[model samples]
Target: MAGLPQSSTYVSLTTFRRTGEAVPTPVWAAPDGDRLVVWTRADSGKVKRLRHTARVTVAPCDVRGRTTDEPVEATAVLLEPHEWRQARAALARRYGWQWRVSYASSKLWQRVTRPGIQRHAMIRVRPA
Candidate 1:
């Protein structure tokens, strides 16, 4: 799936379940050489699941008038701060203009309201 174009691509990450199987969440991701990177809230469910397992599935798709799902498995790693910054910069460049808010403002707000104020998680997924 990493070979596919970055646009219109979404990933579905799965973790173990005591019953049958867990439902997969849709994620936007981009490939960085052999690893794939995705951004999400640090305290998101996906991040919590990653602490339990490192395996996941990624799919590249086209929305067209409809949607398609092409699944592939990969082993994931949560990027350290430095790696997250680099990956984020790359993504922002590809996305063109950056988000208007400054990091300092975000930090200040996080110190207050505290919801979704945590750092973003960069999950690196290597093809399995």
Candidate 2:
């Protein structure tokens, strides 16, 4: 399993719907040993789709999800609750200060606008 370049910051993650339709979303990803880890909202469509199937495709892309490299076949696994903290720490280390600021801002905003709505999950992607 070849890892993505160290400089790569974003990845386009494609998951399939029950009807076989492809849905692509650009997300921040950080290499975690032999796998890639991504953080997202727990109730997001991608997370829901992965519950049905792990099959997925990943590609280097810009922030808008425009693929900049060939897609790679992968399998995605939702992390357990106990692993979330480590995953968040890994993401903070990979993204540096920006992640800290963004996470803080998100927390503040959620508290102000939608209290008790902060549910998040981590997904691990391994090359197939």
Candidate 3:
């Protein structure tokens, strides 16, 4: 990984659609070794895009997805369940109470909206 920002509240994760359109979303990310770990819903559009391609870009950004830094080209991979847990643990260590609160609320929201369908994903991004 090279030139990937670590000191940011959020980052704009840009994923490409099958039509080659860029879709960027601001997300909380924590550095994990040489890569960055991002927590997100399993069915999010970014995950859908990742299913087709690993190519992505990351840049420091605001919560509203406005980029504040140059984008770094990267590749992302969806973690398996066990790896997801490990990756989430890394986020919890980095984000502390904020990660805990967000996790709890997301679970509650899932219960209310999707019933027993609780699914989440951890993305591992390696900058190029």
Candidate maximizing TM-score: 3
| Global Cα lDDT for candidate 3 | 0.90
lDDT of each candidate versus the true structure:
0.63, 0.86, 0.90
TM-score of 1: 0.69
Ranking by TM-score, best first? 3, 2, 1
Error of 1 at 62 (Å): 6.6
Q: What is the C-alpha RMSD of each candidate to the true structure, in Å?
A: 4.1, 2.0, 1.8
Q: Encode model 3's per-residue lDDT on 1-128: one tens digit a residue.
A: 34787989899999999999999999999988878999998989999999999999999999999999889999999988777777888789889999999999988998988888747888999987
RMSD of 3: 1.8
Q: How many backbone clashes does candidate 2 have?
A: 0
Question: What is the Cα-based TM-score of model 2?
Answer: 0.86
In model 3, the Cα lDDT at residue 102 comes to: 92
Pairs of residues clashing in candidate 1: none
Which residue runs does candidate 2 get wrong by more than 4 Å?
1-6, 109-118
**What total of clashing residue pairs does each candidate reach?**
0, 0, 0
- Quality of model 1 by C-alpha lDDT: 0.63
